[model samples]
Target: MTYIDQLGASAKQSAKVIATLSTATKNKILVAVAEELLKSEEEILTANAKDLELACSKGKKPAYVDRLALTSERIIAMAEGVREIATASDPIGIIDTGWLHPKGMEIIQKRVPLGVIGMIFESRPNVTIDAAALAIKAGNAIILRGGSDAIYSNTMLKNIFVRAGIAAGMPPASVQLVEQTERAHVRELISLNNYIDVIIPRGGKGLKSFIIEHATVPVIETGAGNCHLYVEKSADLEKAYAIILNAKTQRPATCNTIETLLLDYELLVAFLPIIAQKLADAGVVLAVDLTCMEILNKHKIIAEHATSADYKTEYQALKITIVAVGGVEDAINHINTYGSGHSEAILTEKMAASDLFAQEVDASSVYINASTRFTDGAEFGFGGEIGISTQKLHARGPMGLRALTTYKYIIRGNGQIR
Candidate 1:
């Protein structure tokens, strides 16, 4: 058998033990892991240094190298994130519903573990702590397959976390890491349906699509937020300026970063120039539709001509596409058809329009007056997330500890016949 197959078998066996573990024990393990991460900061940093050196030699961008470089401060933050996850409410055994049958049986549906989870993520060693924390807290074993870019960092962090769990009286196998960063290894892991109960793909569209198309395992596809920021007719112009700037430039590498700006036609004469000019001034490439283009040129606000493909692009860069919609309904239609079905927001003071947009948009998290960046597990008060699930089945939005769980029916009867 292959190495992945062997790892899968071990994880499957360990998952049986994890599923039956109590919340207290899980939290104990989490707390210990956090403490260990703090104690082992030097070791972790040393490992991260290797990754940084290698990344620099390979000519990786500064931003990319920064992601791989874990400083002392960042290590503490990661530990605290894990500790915060430990303190979140336990998701297991929550009674979804309980009812009595006329035939004299007590039927209760309770949350249960989801068994082993396979998580594929890109460079971000902090995800190592977050994934392991959430998986253990939710009573599920997880196998991490992180990007080769942060190989040394991930390897060291995973060792610390798993060792800490083991020292804290949890099975060490419960938290597994695929040390190999080969693309073939990722494909193999995603394809292991029998052992991995669910797969959480946590990167760009390319990674999510790869798992979606090839994985026989159930997947929670995350992060293809080709998100939007719509400026309504009654929107406060200052609010519009601040919101759009924060959404696009706050962090462009993130999935929730706004890729499109939809303006209500009624506001075109009044607010388009103000919003467009600010974005352009900030070095944001504005891809404008023909209607908006005419207005921009008339006002001498330069912009790039938006093509059909522009609307569909997830520009994880300093860029945004501008489109003019007739009204709220047109805005909703444009979002529903072209959105990646992640997060979409409407900047409207009109309660009715906001309500309608929130109700009609079919994303995991629909925003009324908030930025799409708020579409995160930690922001939703779940501590930290595995990632944002754009898929509709198992979980949606930022997948917290609870999203990693499944439900089971528990029935009780006193020698009753069926």
Candidate 2:
């Protein structure tokens, strides 16, 4: 058999052992993994250096480089994230609901892990530990297929995570990574329906599309964040400015970063110039609509005219598009048309406006008077996230431990017939 097949088979076997592992055992193994990550900081940084150097040689954008580069602080943070996730209560075996049937039967809907997740992601090496810790904590095995750009970083991180788990009495194949950084390996892994229970793609639109189209296994779509933030006329401009700036420039390369800004026309003439100045100071390029350009020009603020393409782009960098919208309704319509159904926010004090925007916008996560960046799983108190699922199938929004599971019904009866 081929290596991919072997990996799948081994993971399938290991998932069974993991699903039955006690919560205490899983937590112990995860804590060990966290400790191992901390211990291997130098080794991981060394390996990550290779990827970072390669990225620089290739002339990747600064934001892209940030995603690839690992600092001592980032390593410490990744370890902390792992430990925090380990502390989360186990998601498995929890009864969703229990009831008595009409025929003297007891019924239970219990949560269980989906065996062997096949995860495809890019750039961020921190996802390596995050994915492994989350998968194991939720009692599922995983097959990670990271981008070729991050191959060196991913390999070393995986080694630390998997070995620690196995040493701590976890399943043999609790976590595995595709060492080969080829598209062919991804193709093969996605088709292994018998082994991988669910496939989650966390990258660009093209990568997610490729996996979605080719995968025979069930797919959970994520990323491609053409996220948006709207400023209502009644918004507190100070609060709005802070939220927009933080959402756009805090970590501009992230999926939760705002790529589009919609403003109530009244706010457009006043708040847009102030917002644009801050973004410009941060070296952000503004692609503005005619109405926005007119107001910006009035305020002597320079901006490029927005192209149609800019509206739909997930500018995973220090760039954002600006548009003057009629009101909350106009903003909602625009978002539904161009948004990636990831995260969207409305900065407004009016409860009516916030509620309307939240209700009408078709996104996995919606916010009022806050940054779209808070859509993150950790921010939502999920510990760590698999991804912000953009699809409306088995899961949506921040995929925490519960999202990694499927439910099974157990009916207790004395040899009950159908």
Model 2, 24-139: lDDT tens digits are: 99989989988998899899989999999999999988888888889889988998898888898788989999999888799999999998999999898899889989999998
Stretches of candidate 2 exceeding 4 Å from the true structure: none
Candidate 1 local accuracy as lDDT? 0.88
**lDDT of every predicted structure (CA atoms):** 0.88, 0.91
For model 1, how does the per-residue alpha-carbon lDDT over 1-418 read when each residue is reduced to its tens digit?
A: 8989988999999999998888889989999999999999889988888888888999987556666779899989888898899889998989999999888899999999999999899878889889999999998888999988888889989999888899887886898889977799888998898899988888767888888899988887888989988888888777778888989988877888899999988888878898888888988889999999999999999899999899999988888999999898999999998998889999989999999999998788887777888887888999999988887887888999889898999999888885
Q: What clash pairs does model 2 have? A: none
In order, how many clashes per candidate?
A: 0, 0
